[model samples]
Target: MTKHFKSAFRQEVAELVVDKGYSIREAAEAMGVGKSTVDKWARNLRKERNGEETHDTPISEERRRISALEREVQQLKMEKEIFKKGHSSLDVGLNEKFALIEEMKGSYPIKSLCDAFEIHRSSYRYWEESSKKIRPEDLRTDIEVKAAHELSGGSAGSRTIATLVTSGGYDLSRYRASKSMKRQGLVSCQPPKHNYKPANKANITIKNNLNREFSPISPNQVWCGDVTYLWVGDRWRYLATVLDLYSRKIVGFALSNSPDSALTKKALSNAFKARGKPTGLMFHSDQGCHYTSLLFRQLIWKYQIKQSMSRRGNCWDNAPMERFFRSLKTENMPKNGYKNEALANDSVRDYIYRYYNSVRPHSHNLGLSPNEKEGFYWKASNWLARKG
Candidate 1:
């Protein structure tokens, strides 16, 4: 090793020379070495006992020298083990334990050793599976990870398996999970559910180009648009609305005898021609046929505006509209069907223009009146419509 470690052993010889009361020549003979070695140590011991420093000092760092000296001091005691009056510091039995672990194949878990050694499970597997490659070292660890995944119902992702490996004391990042699992031919077994509806927004050429993400600082920043069906007399009547989610208010709406592109366009036109559309605004709605229809689709584009559609087949995608429908069914819809068209029409108006906006204590709108919440998001998104 370093010169200081060797010099430390020499220092021990100097001490021995004085303790044994031997002259340089006699000690040199006992040590089976030259007289010069004993003479130098003799001179060094005299200088040290006289509190004088040697000129030929070691050049290593002081800590290295100190550690070497401490190790030498411990070794001096170990030289006189058992039956000697001097103390013995060596654990004498340590090598036996090391040899046992190194030789026995399975007494200790391979996985445990792998973790202790911080070796990869994949490396262990590669060796185990090949007669040419089987590493006697890694076979146990590689098998355990695979077993853990199967035992965990295949629901366990790589992260869980990594945690299992860590419990054995070896740490590994989950980055290797996919690679390891792929080699094992493990596939998560689950049948896929079929959904029939098409996503109109899937075509990039015709997709929603306007990303209408907005923060409503005031009531009219962005408006949510949607249409729901209601039974009036013998036919289907549709109610279209423009809602401000901020206050949960139905600002502009139309009562129509038909569910058509015209119905939805009328609702938007009324909101824009009346209150003025906000600038840089977002208009979100479900992907109902009317909302995605070419006619209404052009209307939105003609205005040079942004449009957002709920992901296809995702009903909760338009949560604000979902809440509006719940309110209508619970509070305004007829117990069975409307007694007649005229009666349903009138009741729908009163609820939308008056009770729903003015009296409903919408839990999600933070208990505030829709009119009170509207101005905040409207002004915040800076979507003030300049045109009718």
Candidate 2:
């Protein structure tokens, strides 16, 4: 008595060789049978199909029924396998289980799989329908949120992104947007807090006139100046920025290797010239040598600008400028700092003029970018002036 393939295996192999055009060797390898055996099977199948006599064994009714039942069991096992693979974590609760059942819908009846897994078919169907309902709108909002976050250089959190999206005329909440971001695996970068030593007090003369009045009635009425350090190359470099409080936009900025009065003066001069030598501007800064220096004060007087200083060691007096620095360093600064001065300069320029001022949404600016906020103000003002 020689061993032979079961009827199903024999037919399947024969079909592979004769009907499907597979070589006898290929069919034998695939079916785990010898080439000679596959060749014989292929010939017998072809002859049988052609109504010629063949030597295949005639199976009894009991044996046939057993084979059919075995086949049904094997098929069910394979379908069940779809749920078993890649779902071993204990966190796979009802939602995850429902997901598995939905995936097996086409392969097996929903009722059958749910009954086998002890899941309610009604619950799974509800989950399926509910998903379909929100999928379209959710997809649109998800894309918008992701775009806003990326535009902020991965620095915008849920609140910021919600503000940005809503400005485009879509109603969105920070919490809802945050949920969408989480579902899409998007997270904002949060830099660690840093504190720096205060500079030597200002000449006992400069006054703290601005007194934390961070909001101004009009652009250029109150411009705040500040200097911060950046890690460049093997040493620290300084960046001076002058922000127009009304628009919350950085009107002028200068980067230097020295943190001195000259650096702060340069930033002011840039802002002064950029704003067409505006007068009656209240320039506020901390009592650093830069802002309090005799030379810098003279430049402020030349523009007929008033100078205001922050209280000693108190950053809150200049909260707008401090907040801007926080956003810049946390959201835009490179993780390892810049490789050199030139790279640092370009990076800072891009963040200020290209991204921050023009693209990023600001909460205080009613979700508009700094530039957009100013533009809106001027547009409306001009329209009102014309109407008058």
Candidate 3:
């Protein structure tokens, strides 16, 4: 290091340190040398009395890093253009890659720059694809269930409708349908809470003499019957039904204060008048004591009607009739208790005589309502006979 300088260069440096308020460090920053070098030059200037160090400031580390990044970006831009062109000429392979990338971008992250243009991130990385996709809520099942419930007046249980849905060839399981239904809060109306199981039905168990056979060739050939309850105003009102097997039509129906012999009798009486008794006709029902009661047996004998009973707890013995009661409850009964008996009565009446008997399509009867099924068959048979 040198001594003092009273000359121009030293004076200029002194002016910078004094007037510009630059320290030896700041001067080193303004110049291109280390602070020590600048200090050595300043000492020498002070001794020899002249000369400036014309070196520029040192490059910053951050600036160098930014420059390297820019170079990489430019290289990638060129590479992307090349890949895009390469794919432009060859149709299949490149399109497939691009499509794969697009699909993965929406689903998974593009792990690298190569993944953006040339390859799929999914192909490179060991990524897991979750299989638990939630099944969507379908109104079709809802509509089907509601239709069944409406047909039965909300009294039919999930089991019967499950049978219908499965038998109808829909790609669904009744178990699944039942679960979905419960989830959706759809209600089953069959099996009113009260009502005893058929009386000593097992002890007296007759042959499924009915064999669940419900089809009839003529209007008065067969009659099917069942019992269900309705919420009447404040108490329960029970309904007894007699369906003409030939048409599967509601030949007789009676709603009474309770489920008793009188209720069944009224229904039978209405049915008798509705379809004038034909000889050798069959009357089938579950082995309920009401049907076996003296009054019922006497009426059957009086009318020359054949009495048939289903085996105990065996609903399919007279499936068509059992199916009917299921339809009525599901279609009409209010789930929470009927607010008023009169309202329940009105709803049940509308469903049975109006909807189930006439409007809703029954898949078994060639998708025709009972009346339509019978009428069509009669027309066909009559036509065939006339031709013969």
RMSD of each: 23.7, 13.2, 17.0
Tell me the TM-score of model 2: 0.64
Candidates sorted by TM-score, descending order?
A: 2, 3, 1
- TM for every model, in the order presented, reads 0.43, 0.64, 0.51
Better of 2 and 3 by lDDT: 2
Identify the candidate with maximal TM-score: 2
Per-residue lDDT of candidate 1, residues 203-314 (tens digit): 3334443233433545556678888888777777888998875567787788788888999999988877666755665678876788888999898887665787766665
| Candidate 3 lDDT score relative to the true structure | 0.64
Worst 10 residues of 1 by lDDT: 81-90
Task: Pick the lDDT winner.
Answer: 2
Alpha-carbon error at 277 in model 3, in Å?
1.9
TM-score quality measure for candidate 1: 0.43
Off by over 4 Å in 3: 1-207
lDDT string, candidate 3, 273-342, tens digits: 7776668788888877778788877887888887888777866667777667766655655566567766
